[model samples]
Target: MFPRTLLCLAVFSASTPLLADTVWLKNGDKLSGTITVFDGGKLLIQTKYAGAVAIDWKEVKTLDSDQHLLVKQDAYAGEVSKSLTAADDGKVTLANGEAPKTVELASIQQILKPKPIVTDLVWKGNVDLALDYQRAEKDTDDYDVAFKTSARHGRWRHTGEGEYNREVQDAETTTNNWRAEYSLDRFLTDQWFWQGRINYKRDHIEELARQRVVGTGPGYQFWDDELGAFSLGSLLNRTDYEYRDGSKDNFYSVAMKWDYNRYLIGKKVEFFTNGEVGKPLSGVADYALDAELGLRYKVTDWASLNLKAERDIISGTNDADLNKTRYTAGFGVAW
Candidate 1:
């Protein structure tokens, strides 16, 4: 019995260090676990006993955490302050407290902590898949899958996206398209940024087997709030296209890109559009454009329904197969 008791003591000591964070409420209540997000208006936390809980930030009297957090300090005299630090005994002191800036248990913008693999990279990602199937004398099967991810550290952010789509009728392949893009951005200020991008695409129907583009330029973020975000940018691109008929060509061009999104109903519904246009320095087809617009209705934590339309057009020349439009509706998920 004495040996068993000693074993239990050892086990408890080993488990103590991984215990959850703690929150003390104004109503004399305490919550245990990690805080997921603590904006000025609301706080979301995950706990072993309660899975996840949302608390009014005003009701939180104090917090005790070792998690690194990004806090948005209340502005004063037209000056705003921000920091990345850990909490200590319900308060955080920054820069000798000259301003004596005390954090109100609320108003934390984001939380990011370094871990073995994930947080070290500060990454977030989503994967979505859409499928359409029709059964009859002639069966149709079409699928679209996309993966998007982004990571940020300091003033730099990196984003990448990959997509694969295919369609078949009566077991005969009708469409096959794949694309990938990667971009890097450096924030010059709140409203301006510098960016560089690399793009690759392939299409079977258009007789284009491979296309690669590299561009670099500046961008603007006009609006980024609860409503959504709006951004526009332009770049000078070097493009190379390889056709299925063993034909290849390369050129230089100027490209413009715009992306926008809005939340329509609380956090459940969203509308988004992404588009780009490029004008070749010298070509019979002077310009090309690509655009995608979509609406998503979230159904569950990991699932959502979406409707989308996509268009691609080339102007000043007559290549019938080079321009196409498609509409799709299906489901998507994120992590």
Candidate 2:
């Protein structure tokens, strides 16, 4: 009876220890505890002291001290060969035994699991709609409605907005404006990237004027993971403006803009400044300088509220001297 009891005790001890086993490899690396999940080229191991350690499956040498494990049993557990080669492009190539596979890194979706040391792709978009009204003591009553959409996929992004405004006072007038922009960002290093963008805008005011502008430029990006990013760029704009009373003007502009953004509470706050100098190409205009300052508060994932003030520092023609200050406040939505 005592021999049978000792046998049962030994069996329980071996099974229990295996359930909480720690794998010690020959390469001086130690992995404590049992592995719970293995997927997406990562091993989710739950340890006793270090909590969870997600080690790259490709970096692992052997498992359980079994030579048979070296055989390629599963797609995720294939044996890889390591090699070092010199390329003609002056770049050193370090090859692992695994065959070069075309990974859809851009389409990867990140999922959070039991253990949390993995990085995943982020893609999102939002849409918003807003209405605005303003009353100035001396000017006309201003009303506006806007729609906007913003989207990001991998390192590419796009934004579009359209707005309709009416001044319901002595000289009633309506205006419509639309803007669309697309940008591509390429990471040159961990903290820096190159950016390129194309933008277009059209504005029409009832019986007063119509204008169209198109621009494209390259820029630089400085990103702070927690504090957002700052960007500086120069754009070349070609504008065609026509007035209601049979007057026409054309101009070319070189503009510089700076953007700053930060997150506060659950909202993103952005500040922007734009300065442009325009040289007349035809008609009765000389040169013009314009400046704008604006602030935006993100209200939702797809909507924001903004306030802006603009001034024309130098007028191009005596007939259309825009030496007055203009203020605008509105809400915008994007999808």
Candidate 3:
């Protein structure tokens, strides 16, 4: 009986590497893990012994895996193989069919898992919330929640964001507002795309009670890789505003929008900023701006602490000019 048990244990131990993704280093080190992503010259692997590990792609001698992966080659438009097979140094065999192909390792640009329906889908997003209360003479309470998400499959991408804020002091509501926006992008080429977006804002206590905007324009993606992403857009918009005193204003505007984020310290810390600035063509308002900037420190794989500052401004409204700034710190979860 003891001899049979020993045989079973040996079989399991010998078969472990066959089921995992393996990376062979030039220095004769072998790593058994699941490949998470490879971008910005860093290949990330999730290992059981250690946490997620980032390895410089240049140092890898070769890699092998049985799972379907999407591998993009720099300046190459050919269809990628379904899986990878280890080859000689500085090369890998792409397992396509009866006819496998070999390619130089330096030509590989990105590596990621393929989705079931969409072979090339990259999705990422986050949600954050903050709350505050005071028991002093003035008794105050504040709540804020914001979220942004994006998904890209093939040539199409969808992005959306929303935020809500409220504050109360001595049983009186001082602020109540919420806003949402959505945009769609169809990639015309690798880095250029067209976008159409719609936005709505509502404030219960402010004189500028409601706002609506629809815009379309061109955008450029600077870089989107393992380290971070940045994009800038220019839009032409038609906007309408409603005031608490039953007044209304309409105008045409042109705006510039920016979205940017970066990972630091091996992706344990993140810095992100996004916002829009616009000038009204018809002078319904001279200029308007809405923006936020923040930093997040990851405490665990999915939990984080964040600090953020937000600014909103709308000058030259018919009934009132508005300017507001807010700061918050809180904990949240991220994927």
Across 1-335, the per-residue lDDT of candidate 2 in tens digits comes to 99999999999898884545334333558686755434445555667777656655555443321111111223212322133232222122224446522222122112122212212222333333334444566345565554434443234445454444455554555445444555555544333445555554444543325555665555555542233346665666676666667686666766565554554543367565554555555544566555656667877645777777756543555345545355777776532
Minimum summed lDDT over a 10-residue window in model 2 is located at 64-73
> Which residue runs of candidate 2 sit more than 4 Å off their true CA positions?
1-141, 146-150, 174-208, 224-226, 266-314, 317-319, 328-335
User: What TM-score would candidate 2 get against the native?
Assistant: 0.47
Q: Itemize residue pairs with steric clashes in candidate 1.
A: 40-107, 97-100
**What is candidate 1's CA lDDT for residue 128?**
71
Question: Distance (Å) between predicted and true CA of 24, model 1?
Answer: 8.9
lDDT of 2: 0.48
Query: Each prediction's TM-score against the native?
Result: 0.73, 0.47, 0.90
lDDT of 3 by residue, 1-335 (tens): 99999999999899875588999999999999898988768889899998788888999999998777788784223355778899999998999989988989899877878677766677888889899998898999999999899998666899999999999999999999999999999888878989999999999999999999999999999988778899999999999999999889989999999999999997899999999999999867889999999999999988889999999999987688889999998888886
Best candidate according to lDDT: 3
lDDT of 1 at 262: 81
The whole-model lDDT of each prediction reads: 0.72, 0.48, 0.89
Descending-TM-score candidate ranking = 3, 1, 2
